[model samples]
Target chain A: MAYQRKRICRFCEAGVQYIDYRDEKRVSRFLTERGKIIPRRVSGTCAKHQRMLSSAIKRARILSLLPFVSDNPA
Target chain B: MSELRNYEVTFIAEPNFDDERVNSLVGKYTEFIEKNGGTVEKVERMGKKRLAYAIEKRQYGYYIYTEVKMPGEAVAPLKRWFALSEDVFRHLAVRMTDRDVRLKAVTTEHYRKEMDRRNAATRPGAREGGFREGGREFREGGRPERRDD
Candidate 1:
C-alpha cells in the first residue's frame, strides 16, 4: 500500500468559528494573484469553511477591504 | 412589537473627516438608533484606510463599525436614513444570530495556539519530508503532484 498524507482544513485546525470579513490580510492569502478566490480543491479548505470564506470575501469586497478584481497581476 | 435583535452596521465616510467630525458622526448615529427604538452597544472608529479599489474616485475612506440592538422594523428606516444621508458613502447592516455572537467571542488565544501548532508541524524535516515547502516549489514549475502512491 502507498502512503498518503491527509489534508486538514486550516480553519478547522485553527478553531476558527467565525471568519471575519474585516480580516482582509488572512483572506487575501486564499486568493490567487489575480484576486480570484482559490477553489476548495486547490486550497484544501473544507466545504463548509469554503462557503464561509467565499461569503466573507464577497462581503469584504463590498466594504472595500478586498478588491473585486486586481488592477495589477502582481 | 418584535423582540430586539443584535445587528452590526458598518459605514464608510469621506476620508477627510477629522477626529471631531467622526465623534460627532458617532453621536449622531447613536441618537438615531435611540430614536428608532434601538440602543447602541458599541462604536469603533477604524480611522482612514486605503480602499482596495477607488470608490467615487477616492483612494481612502474612514470606517465606522457599530453594534446595535433594535427591533427588525427599525432596520428599514435606518437603511433609508443611510441612503438619504450625504455623509455616508457606503453602508452595510448585518443581522447577528446567536452563532455569530458565540463565534465573535472566541479569543485570540485559540488562534495563537493554532499558529504555534502549525509552525511546529512545518519545521524542516518534521514529517512527510517537509512536503509543504517543496510543494510550492513544484507548483511554481507545474501543477502539484496529485498521485496518492
Candidate 2:
C-alpha cells in the first residue's frame, strides 16, 4: 500500500464542541459547490463531529441561512 | 410530568415590519410563553438580514431569538402559533440538552479565538467576494459545447 498522510478533524483541532447552524459562513466550508454536504471521508471530520455538522447544516437550511441547492452550481 | 426545561426559539418574521410592529410581536410572544407556564429568559432581535434563498418570495427576514424555560407542553402550542401566524415565515425550537449547554461554552470560546486569529491573518484583498469562500472549486460555465446533427 502507498503511504498516505492521515487527516485530522478540523473541529477536534479547533476544540469545537458545538457547531452552530447560525454560523453559516463556517458551515458552508463543508458543503460542495452544489450545496450538498461533503462526506466525512472527504472532509476528514471524525464521526462524532460529522454527525453534529450534518444536523447543523440541516437546521441552517431550514432557517434559510444556507441554501438547500445552489443556483449557481460552480 | 416533565420538568421545566430551557429551549431556544428562533423565528423569521416579515422583513417589512416596522420597529413598533416588531416590538409588539415580541411582546405578544413573550406574553404567550408566560401564559403557557414558561418564563422568558432573554429575547434578542437579530434584525433584518438576507436569506440564503427566497422564502415565500421574500429575500430578507427579521430574525428573533428567545431563550425560554418551559414545560414540554408549551412547545406544541408555540409551534401552532407560528404555523397559524402570517407574520412569521419560519421557526425552530430546540430543547437545550446538558451537552448543548456545555458545547455552548466551548464553542463560544473557540469562536472568539478563531475570530482573533482570523483578524490577525486577514489582509486587504484577501477575500474578493462572499461566493467563492463557500465553494472550493470554480469552473467557467459560460458556454456549452453544441454539436450539429
Candidate 3:
C-alpha cells in the first residue's frame, strides 16, 4: 500500500503573513466571546503567524477596538 | 538633541471593563507619552476579541493602539508603567521610522483592497457557488494543496 502523508499548512509553507494586531478586521475573526484569539489548534494558524497574530491580538485588546468580552451573552 | 521618532504602542487590557475604565487606562498611557515630550498622533480603541489561546485563563480582552512621536529615552519609562499596571495584560512599543510609515501605508492600502475583493465576492447574487472551496477543505483536513500559489 502506498503511504499517504498529511499535508502541511500553506500558511506555514508559503509563509503567508498572519494578521497583525493593528489590522483590526483580520484579527477579529479569530477572537472568541471575550474578544480573545482562539489558539492555533482552533484557529489553524501556522506557528510564525500565530506568534505575530497573538502579539497583534494583545495589542488590539489593549487599544480597545475589541471588547474584553461580549457585552451581551450569546 | 535626539532625533524625534514615531512609535506605535499597543497593549491588551483586562476583559469586561466598562468603556470609561478602559478609556481611563488609555488616557494614563497617553499622558505618560505627552509628559515625556511625545506627541500622540492617534489613539484608537479596538474593542474586545477572543484570544488565539487562553491568556491568564481569560478568553477575551480589550485592545488599544496609540501612535506617538517621542525621543527614544521615553520608551523605558513607558515600559515601566506598563509593567506596573495590572489592567494592562501585554504591551509592545515599536519605533516607526520614515520607511516604516511608508510601508505601513502601502500595507494598509493592500489590505483595504483585499477586504473589498472579499466583500464583493461574498455579496448576495454574485458568483453563486463560487465560494472558496479550498478554505473549507484546508480547515477540515489541514491540507496545503488547496492554497493558491
Candidate 4:
C-alpha cells in the first residue's frame, strides 16, 4: 500500500498573515540548499501565498540575508 | 513636503569600515535626514557577515538598517546619498506602509519562533545535526519516480 501524508499550506496552517523579507531563517526553510525556491506543488504552499513568499525571498537575497545561488558540490 | 511617510533603508557596507567609521556614516545620514525634515526612528547594525556569494572578491559585508519618517520624495535623495558613499556597496530604500510595519513585526516574531525551535532541538534524544544549508543534495527537477519492488 502506498499511502502518502496529506500536504498542507504552511502559512495557512501556522496563521502567518504576512511574509517578511528580513526573516531569512524562516524564509530559508522554503528554499533548497542550492538557493532555489521550492515549487508550491512540492512545498504544499497555496498559490496566493507562494507568490508573496517568492517575491519576499528574492528581496531577502538582494539584501544578502539569503544567497542567490548556493554553491554546487558537484 | 505634504506629509512624512515611513521608510526603511537597508544597505551592505564594505567590510573594511570600522565601528567608528560606520557610526560616523550613520550619524551623517541621520543628520542629513533630519535636515530634510525626516525623523529617524531607529537604526540597526547587523555587523559583519559572510556573503552567500563573493562580491568583488570580498567574502563578507557589514549590514545596516534604518527606519525613518520622511516625505516620499526624500527617499530618492537618500538613495543618491547612499550611491555617493564609496563604502556602501549595495543599498535600497523602500517606502513602508502600515502593512509593512505589521510585516516587519513578523520578522521579529520569527526570531522568537527560531529560538523556541532551537530549545526544542536541544532536548533529550533530539537530533544533534541540523538541516544541510548547502543545498548540495537537492535535485531541481520533477517528482520522485515510483517503482514496484
Candidate 5:
C-alpha cells in the first residue's frame, strides 16, 4: 500500500496566528533538549511557519524563557 | 582569512511594540551582519509568547532568531549591537563547529517528535478530567491548577 502524505503545517488550523517563544509550555514542543528547533520535515510544520517557529525558539533561548540545553532527561 | 564559524543569535523584544517596528529592528541586525562580511543563513520570526518570568514587569515578548556564518571576530560587534538596543531584552551567541551543526540537525528531529508527543497528550479527552500524573492543569482563565490530589 502507498503511504499517505500529511500536510506540512500543523498550525494552519484556522485562528492560530502567532508563534510564542516565552511560553515554554508551548515552545518546548518545538525544541530539542540541546535547544535546537525541530525542522518542518519532522515537525510537519509548513516551510513558512517552521521558519517562524525556529526564530521563536531561538529568541526564547536568549531570553532564558527556554534553556539552551535540556536539563531534564527525554 | 580566519576560518568561518556558524553562530546562532537569538533575541527577545519587549512585547508592546508594533510588529512593523519589530521587523525593522530585526532588519537592522541583518544589515549589520551583511556589512560585517557575514552570510546570514536564516532569519526566523517567532511570535509572541508568555515569559517564563516577568521581564521589566512584562509577561511576554516577541522573539527573533538569526543564523550566520562569519569569522570569530564578528561576535564582538554583534554583542555590542545587542547591548545597545533597548528593544532587545536578552541575547546569546553560540559558536558552532562542523560537528555541532550536524548534531543540531539530528537533535532537531528528536525535538519535533517530542513536541508532537506533548501536543497529543494535551488534546481534549487524552486523559480523564484533563489531568495527568505530575502534570498541572491550565484552566481556561489562564491560571494553572495546582495538583493537590
Candidate 6:
C-alpha cells in the first residue's frame, strides 16, 4: 500500500469543543467551493466533531449565515 | 418562578434599514425577550453582509445575535412572535442546558484521549482510519445522453 500521510482531525487537534454556527469564517473552511460540507474522510474531522460541524453548517444555512448551494457558474 | 435557562437567538434583518432604525429593531426584540421573562445577557450585532444567496431578492442581510436566560416554556412563544414579524427574515433559537454545557466542555477532551489510545495500539505509524465512499465509477444520466442519436 502506498504510504498515505497521517491526517489528524484539525478540530480534534485544535481542541474545538463546540461548533458555533455564527462563525462563518471557521464554518466556511469545512465547506467545499460549492458550499457542500466536506465529508469526514476528506476533512479529517473526528466522528463527533463531524456530526457537530454538519449540524452547525445546516443551522447556519437556515439562518443564511452560510449558503445552501453555491452561486458560482459550474 | 420557573427555572431560568440559557438561550441564544440569531436573526436576520433587512439591510435597507438605517442604523438608527436597526438599533430600534434590536431594542424592540430585546424588550420582547425581557417581557417573555428572559434576561438578555448580551446582544451581538454582526452587521450587514452579503448573503450567500439572495433572500427575497436581496443580496445582503443584517444579523443580530442575542443571548438570554429564560424558562424553557417561554421559547416557543418568542419564536412564534419572530415568525409573525414582518422585518425579520429568518431566526434561530438554541436552548442551552446544563447537560449541553458540560458536554461541550468535555467531548473534546474525551475524544482526544480516545484517539490517542487507539493510535497507540495501531501499527508503528498506522492511522486510526477514516471512511471513504467508493461510489459508482460511471456517472448515470437521468436523461439519455444526446437522446441516443
DockQ result, candidate 3: 0.14
lDDT of 2 at A34: 89
Rank list by DockQ: 2, 1, 6, 4, 3, 5
Docking level of model 1: acceptable
Which has the higher lDDT value, candidate number 4 or candidate number 5?
4
Across B21-106, the per-residue lDDT of candidate 6 in tens digits comes to 88898888888878888888988888887887788898888888888898888888888988898888888998777876676658
Estimate the Cα RMSD of every predicted model relative to the unseen true structure.
Answer: 8.5, 11.2, 8.8, 9.5, 14.8, 14.4
Retained true contacts (fraction), each candidate? 0.53, 0.83, 0.10, 0.37, 0.30, 0.60
Per-residue lDDT of model 1, residues A25-72, tens digit only = 988999888899998877788998999899889989999998899979
Between candidates 1 and 3, which one is better according to DockQ? 1
By TM-score, the better pick of 1 and 2 is 2
**When only chain A is evaluated, what TM-score does every model earn?**
0.87, 0.89, 0.66, 0.87, 0.73, 0.88
lDDT of 1 by residue, B29-145 (tens): 999999989999998888899998899899999999999999999999999988888888898898889788778668355667646644654564345576666444434236343
| lDDT, candidate 3, B1-149, per-residue tens | 37679988878888788899987887788788889988889988877867644677988878777888999988899899998999988777887778767756776676676566456445532445645652343242343333453
Measured by DockQ, the strongest candidate is 2
Once superposed on the true structure, which residue ranges of model 3 sit more than 4 Å away at CA? A1-74, B117-149
For model 2, state the Cα shift of residue B9 in Å.
0.8
Pitting candidate 1 against candidate 4, the one with the higher TM-score is 1
Off by over 4 Å in 2: A1-6, B114-149
How accurate locally, in lDDT, is each candidate?
0.83, 0.85, 0.70, 0.78, 0.70, 0.77
lDDT, candidate 4, at B74 = 80
DockQ of 5: 0.13
| Separate DockQ for every predicted complex | 0.47, 0.58, 0.14, 0.27, 0.13, 0.29
Candidate 1: Cα lDDT at A63 = 92
Predicted candidate 5 versus true structure: per-residue lDDT over B73-147, tens digit per residue: 888988998889888977777676787567556655655765664564466435556446324342334535323
Q: Residue-wise lDDT of candidate 2 within B39-68, one digit each (tens)?
A: 999998999999989998999999998889
Q: Which segments of model 1 are wrong by more than 4 Å? A: A1-6, B107-109, B112-149
